[model samples]
Target: MSHDDGYGNDSGRTGDGYSTLGGTRQTRTRLPDGEGGDGYGPRRPPRSSRSLVTVVGVIVLLLAAIAFANLGGGDGDKGGTSGGSGGSKAGAAPTAATGTKPVTGKNGEIAAGFSQDQQGAQSAAANYSVALGSAEMFDKTKRDEILGNVIAPSAVGGFRKTLDQAYSATLFKNLGLNEDGTTPTGFTFISRTTPIGTKVTKSSDEQATVEVWCTGLIGLAGEGSTKPVTDGWFTITMELQWINGDWKAVTHSQKDGPAPVGSDTRASSADEIAGAVNGFGGFTYAR
Candidate 1:
């Protein structure tokens, strides 16, 4: 709100934002008249009618200030909605921390106790989640590459054997792909998981539980396809331990949801969703 400051106006400013002033503003202080104290002064005369206008002006200004304050505050209210069914993709990212640090001493403490270096441990965790939740995990050849690259040398044999049987022939065929895991005719199979956030659930010198909350796009998204794109959310918790100067995944598990209700708009064609996903990139999380 603009203020007269009893003379000149404030420059380079207008009503910038709203603030709630119901409790924030102070009532105008009138000059004290001749009273029990300060006895030498004569009685003051009645003030001018302009005082009424000034009082009204101050009230409007205070309300405007309140509105400005609310805008700066992060609230449950947002400008747009996704057809009022789910949150808009354009909604500003809601923050959990008001003034919190991304990393405190927990991760540092765990790393310090480990025989391995800290950089190696964090890098290992980041890359391991990428590999485990990638689209390439659907194909045996890519799966082998991922296991070789991300999993520890000692754990590779068991990891590959377990996952090899887990992603079976029938499962691949059901994913709108060829028996060898190629995209079928008139179909574009999509299986991508993007991490939204990561946290150290529990950390120690030898072991830690890093939980990765993720969102994934699954099913085929293409023309003439029976499998339409579907979105799901899950939190995958990986147990990590220090070995060979690096953190390696000991085991991990997933639990579904925090899912929003489906929307009422016309469902976009598989091609559209596929095109959007292909064009837009997933974010690299900070906290």
Candidate 2:
């Protein structure tokens, strides 16, 4: 609503996203005399008119106050809850912290013994995504160990057979690593997955399906390297089952991303990238 400033002019927005005052003519209001005037004679608006103006002013102020409250209170009402379901609107993704502590136990280097809830399934999916995408998985021994730990017992053999074929010598060579999956001396092979977020698509006491959105660093980081460290976005979906008192992946698969556009930031040098990967530690994700 635009305001009239007693000159038949409306004061508010113009169509071009800017504010402007628009008027075609002046408007004059004549009123009865003396006391109710502007402390001068014959210029005062009538008492009834003055009351109506006061009421309108109060109503505008009240409406503005309500609008302001609504704008500020929307998110405050939904934050601090878990399960990726808290925000300004229904079904919105959560952006606030869940306030739940990360899992403390470890099965070797892998996170283990996740809580048997929706959050636990999401956490397990995230950690498994990291483990499966790690450089360790390029090595046959470590790869088998990781599968054993994260995969359900009934699915372990199938996973091992599938991964063995997937991580072939050609893949290692293409990634600038030795056929045996070791870093050719003086180069650091990076295959780390950092989970950006997680969502539980289906959940029950016995089984749950989770999708972990992740950003990954891969390739070799070193001076004069054939394959420089590059990043990619992808999502890994894992079907988890409550097996042997913990959540384990029954089936897991990857798909190419809900990717964001690349930024214009300059790429770091090989040594800087390698140094960063060495210096920084990885985190265990929680819901």
Candidate 3:
């Protein structure tokens, strides 16, 4: 797969073959060539007007039903009731929260002091994923601080070197940032990862493997920005160890997603997106 870093003049191609602004590659649709007459030859006979109207009405009803079904769990009171068995309750509590309070301690700006249980592992994985994918990772000092806080002590040295190589000057330039990863005078650089949910694939008293399904927004948002902001889904697998009384990532890797289909919501303008990114504060995710 071509790694487009998600910014730049070459139609969103960074020198590293990845776009700093991530996006789902849109597939083009091709229309069939019609038989004769400039590809517009014989048109099909029109359906009955009444039949067409009925079909349209059914489609509208189906869409409404889908919309309502999606809203079912939004109400706090309706979220986790015991619906009858036989799969009726399945959607009622899909991954109910463990009810543990989020970590309030901070190691510099990163969340710290996660519990050593499965819930703690999931929480640590989710929070670490966000910190690792944030725009601060582009700055060397902040990146070092983040890695030092989140990565296991033994792994930090090697991982820091590897990440330094990954976030190269070329990649920064492609992202429309300076060599030091600072945004230009009139631009806002955004890179954020929000974990949808986390699962412990394997766990033990001392170690855990957690998967964080996440959606990320990345790009340069400004007037005349070549790479418009976009979002993409991905999963991060973290191998965590209970070291020094907390869950720390020993190793982690990312893979392109179990992404949902794109929504039909209209895209926001660059200024609107820039404003939102700057205005909104991220969550301290707990599971």
RMSD of 2: 27.8
TM of each candidate vs. truth: 0.54, 0.67, 0.69
Instruction: Give me the candidate number with maximum lDDT.
Output: 3
What C-alpha lDDT do the candidate models reach, one value each? 0.38, 0.50, 0.52
Q: What is the per-residue lDDT of model 1 for residues 112-217, given as tens digits with 9 covering 90 to 100?
A: 1222322223334444544454556666777677655544455455445534443444444444457766778766665556666555534434554455565555
Which candidate number maximizes TM-score?
A: 3
Question: Which residue ranges in model 1 land beyond 4 Å of their true spot?
Answer: 1-127, 263-266, 282-287
Indicate whether candidate 1 or candidate 3 has the larger TM-score.
Answer: 3
Worst 10 residues of 1 by lDDT: 4-13
Task: Give stretches of model 3 more than 4 Å off.
Answer: 1-94
Q: Give the Å error, residue 62, model 3.
A: 46
Name the lDDT value of residue 214 in candidate 1: 59
Per-residue lDDT for 57-176 in model 2, tens only? 221121111110001001111222222222111232553466878899998899987877667777887887677666676677986788788766665665455345444454455456
State the number of backbone clashes in model 1: 11
Stretches off by above 4 angstroms in model 2 are: 1-95
TM-score of 3: 0.69
Clashes of each: 11, 1, 11
